[model samples]
Target: MKKRSGAGLRARVGAIFVILAATVAVVDGCNGQNSIVGGACVTGYVACADQCVNTAVDPANCGSCDVVCPSGVACLDGLCGGPVDGSSDGSALGDGSSGDGSAGDGSFGDGGDGGCEPPFNRSSACGACDVVCVAPNSACLADPSGNFVCAPPCTPPLVECENACVDTQTDPLNCGVCGKFCPSNLCANGVCQGATPGDVVVLGHDYSSGAAGSSQAKVLTNAVFIPPSNPLRVLSYEQFADAAAVARVKSLVQSAAFGRTVVFTPSTTSADLASPTLAQSYDVVLVYDQQGGAPANLTTIGASWVTSLSDFAKAGGVIVALDGAAGQGGMPQLLTSAGLLAVGGHQTIPAGTPVAVVAPADRIGAVVASPYGVYNRSVSLQAVEPEGPNVIYVAKQLVNGTPANPVVVHKIVNP
Candidate 1:
């Protein structure tokens, strides 16, 4: 409180300065104990709890000193786990490094080129894609309805218009011309069908026959009509052995390399079967029609005939029959008698008024020639025995064109 001399004041001020220096040294020592030396800031060396640290390169904590790693590894957050192997160099299984497929192996993910298009499959280029059918037959023209059909110039004649071929026969826009579309209403297939009166042209005419008019019907080089048995012979129960029917069958054999004939037999005898033998002698018989119409006596066609027919068909001759006309009775009984399983038989298309006709697109059958009576023409085929291969040609308005509904049904015996 009193003012001292200059010397005394000097001494007192020096002492106060020393005390302040000593206090600073003690505070610094305590701080040093909790701090790190160089970069070894970790426990057991120079560290504190409740704080972040890097055990790596920490001399006091070499490998993992209190959650600290060695120098080689970096301290990620506060853990000293292990050294990171950053060498993902082209050795992984699904890394796309194999240069084959995608970045995934089929075991774990997708595989292959991811498609079945061109260069992928040995067959179709525009075929299945990604295991599913895709743009098939790029050569075919697609209808507006998304139906892809063969275009013009149907290759390998007789092939129907499909994905690879366009049937120019019935194409009104391209009749007889490859890719050439026929005018409106022009029917075409391999050949034209449904010619109007006098529309058909004969190769030769015979005016010599004064009363015989033309004395000749239009003939097709590749086509032949398949006629049924003459509806006569009610007493003998034998199919009418007409020379015309026989000659017609022979003509069919001569024309087609492969032929099918269904000959109705009322009474089976060695004589009645002679024609079928002749029919089979020349061409491969696809079918033999032995089912006669309602016979006067259904039970009299000797068992030998039935046996022969069955044997012949079993040897690959196609045998077709009506509902109950094949073996002295209906299909059920006839098939049993034939020693064959009746796979398919008598099912009739209920007789309906003729609505329209459908023709096979094959070269051998009737086809659309002209567009005159092509669409929605009412017509019907009387199916007395329904169980067979129901087939009909589209020809309602004219005798030349085929009818819509199936006119013929070739039932296959399952056995």
Candidate 2:
């Protein structure tokens, strides 16, 4: 082979360098990081009709070459869409933001971040984004001010009470009006069962009052006064460690007078007491003393249980606690913890003490005659003390002819 000249060698090397540069350009362009060969198009640009174009924001070539966007729409992230910034021109792709624009401010329209697009008037996003309306009954409606809002769940002849749709004219829990519960669970044409609407009614004692024929037993039986037509569904807790106390409660509730109007269900457990669903299924919750006259078990009476009980009482459900059930770690403690009772404790009254009607003319006092005595010789009575302002002392025990220690009390937790 003939030896190459220096000028020819330099020309060959320069050609090789040009070829290598073109190869690098092709590789870089394929990787979407630089311009392609012949400098036809840069990164994020596509060759169209011998010209480079950015399809992402080009209205004339939206998403692809020659794909023109419609009028009043903007090419946004390879898609044609209307403006989300309340502009009629459709100049802005989103609300002037590149990420989720909701910001939890209950706004609507596209956020441009590929997140969920809230429906205009859906129940899950009523009136505004994330503003959920009450389910199963409510709907989104325009208010008088021309603004979208959640309409009440109730229709004509019914009203919304505590997020529930009910007929005030017939609902015992909302007799005549919302949050007006009838103690007897009876409502007739918006009227409560008893003669007085706000009268206090007391029932039951701390312990057993001897046989059913005893005067104390008769007094308690008469005080219940629930109508037979509108029977009460009672949920009784089985967590009472004392079998004797449980038996006594069963006897009292199962008596001929009480059994007729009271349907007792003794299937509640410690876990069940914490469930609001189970609590709402009954009209009354009965919690009596535990083993050795101790208060209710702290493990059973937790924060959730107390909250369920308080909510039950506020929703027209009655809570009947007996003996040490109202003592420390029991209903009193629960009430105090829930801020329903300022002070909570119990007083032990000697056996055979006389009970006097303190609030005569009240529904509870009207049921029993004054100067009554407990017939049970072995069992003593427990009187809950320092009642909240909402509580009404119906009867008190007379120790040595002096009235003291509340034996029977009544309260209607409206709040």
Candidate 3:
């Protein structure tokens, strides 16, 4: 080839540059057949099957070309199954809102608050977020006031202790209160049982011999024997027919002459009887007759109260019912209802009647004075003829020098 002139060389080079520019335009633009002439894609896009696509957000080409996401999943930042932002091409899951079963705000269920599903009332997230309720006997429940709260999963008499429903009155590990373990593991009537012998006191009916009047001291000395180590705690329901009767009992028990330490708690209503926690606090329950000479109605006292009293007795708590306390709707009715007494009813006994101790070997017989005389108006269960293996006829009234009816009866209820 011969050396060409500068003008001719410059004209040829200019024509070649024009042809190269045309070729570049053809590669960058789409061909008429809907395909690129060459592999030339945008800065943030990739070439796939003769097409230029942004694989970062495209569901069909997510992450990499032809890497399609699931039907209800979104492709974000080159990853599948990411939270949707609504700016996506209406092909992703969820409405990108707080609720609407969207994963954007962690509301996959019935959405109440963020980060929790199914209204956030579950035990794992009770009431509010991240509020997990303790388990076993506790749960997330709606209170009476219509608010969600964490409460024990036990009924009235049963309390929650150590993640279990337990009866404090009988449970040795939780006697009277939770975490109050008894060393001897012998819990009776919510009190730790000792090796000392226990006795039951009967405060009903007047014990008199001629003009000696009420032999309260003699009866108490023999019947109500409490060991010095374990003091007697008495809960007296002051609904007696006569105020003097209550005052007499109080004075006799509280006076230093009584010998033992007696803690007397008197109340007008039967509210404490309904609660096992409250009822088990005392060693004895004294039920007195009301002004009408009839005991408090069991129906009015409620079933829960009756049950509590029965449990108290069954757990070794002493019950001293006076005079009319065994009348139509009194302690006798309660005992019958509680299954503590199979047969229980009352009958009026004439004043100044002679009473004799039938079983001298029995505890009540050994204590009660023989040939006992009744001073004030007294009542007896002799007419009803209360009978059972636990029943003990300590004394009986003598009518015309013969044993007529049972005057003083004792029922032995084993715990």
Candidate 4:
């Protein structure tokens, strides 16, 4: 080991520097553009002429240092093109694969167990997101990959009415509540009323469904004066009649000489007082013992019937009304309109022979007695309107001053 002076030391240091530089150059050549720490390509970018660029991210070359992006993606900042917000070229791509299950930031079947393709939810089918389903009538089938198919399977059966559904066959109001119901046996209110010659006579030839005179067709059949050969034809409208009365009328007709020639019409719905044919077709229009006269759907006989019946009476048609129809409120207005008097709050004839016409004089008489069998001195008589030259058949003096109010006022109109 020779000791050297300052000048010799300088020369030795310079030589060592040169050798180190050479060694570094050799290492760089072998490693090929890499960092000393790792064998990675150290960006592998080529400085061609002026710009520093990675040929892999350039349009000319891609993948390897010599490769580049295809036509769609362009190189930018030494890398391939980044995603655009709304580019028109239409291509699928992914930025990163950072996701969990359904809660992942990635798309619906993106990153889960087997790409999350099984257990299809009905809510997300037919290209819908976050849901899956088969449409109505579609069958659900599984694919080879265990994915559900979404489509209608087959046509469903038609709906039909069944069991305990009301029979519209006989119900006048609700004929055949459900299902196909034929007009079976001409039933009304569950009771069959067969049509006969009498039904034709009473309802008239022009009568159709829900005729007003349907009940009167039955009543005229029971009339004692109506001959079987020449039955009286009448059409009348009644709101309601007593069930017992209907049975009675039915029985009376059954007992007649003819074994039931005239039959009641099968159905009689609510009557329309507006029809004049209902008025003119009948000889006698009698609304008898009618309860619930002011029907739920109709106004009381306050104006129309009052006015029309007055016209009918003037035309010489006899209109008989019994009970509620002839009660104080209804009959008084009608009688007064027809020019007649009606009196009776509390008055009754003798239980047995209370009402009678005096013989030879054509005078009507009634003897009213108290509930205790004592005959009250005063009697009541109601004189109907349409007053013309008429005879008083029988009477009782009510007021002491006048010729005594007639207890029984029988008027002979056109007599």
By lDDT, is 2 or 3 better? 3
Clashing pairs in 3: none
Model 3 C-alpha lDDT per residue in residues 1-415, reported as the tens digit of each score: 6777897555444533432332232223222122222123334446677555545445677778899888744454456744333222211221233333222222112222232233535555454433445644147677687645556567768888756889988887777766554556888777766432223333336322123223323444334433222346677777434566667656655553345566677877768766675434766676555434333465355344666766666655666655442225365554454443433566666666677777778755665567776656565553343545667666677778877666555666555
Which of candidates 3 and 4 reaches a greater lDDT? 3
Ranking by lDDT: 3, 2, 4, 1
TM-score, candidate number 4: 0.29
- TM-scores of the candidates are 0.24, 0.45, 0.46, 0.29
Runs with alpha carbons beyond 4 Å of true place in candidate 3: 1-217, 220-229, 254-258, 293-299, 302-304, 325-335, 338-345, 383-385
Where's the lowest-lDDT run of ten residues in candidate 4?
199-208
lDDT leader: 3
Error of 4 at 241 (Å): 3.5
Q: Which scores better on TM-score, 1 or 2? A: 2
lDDT tens string, model 1, 1-415?
6668897555444433432333233223222232211122222122334211223223224334464445443332123321232111111121224423221121211223222223312122111112111222224333466533323323455333333455556664334433332224565443323332111011111111111111111122222222111111111122423333334333433333234332333443434433434222211222222344233322233233465554444333333222211233233333333443322333222222222223334222234233222111111223223332332222232333433333222323222
- How well does candidate 1 match the true structure in TM-score terms? 0.24
lDDT of each: 0.29, 0.51, 0.52, 0.32
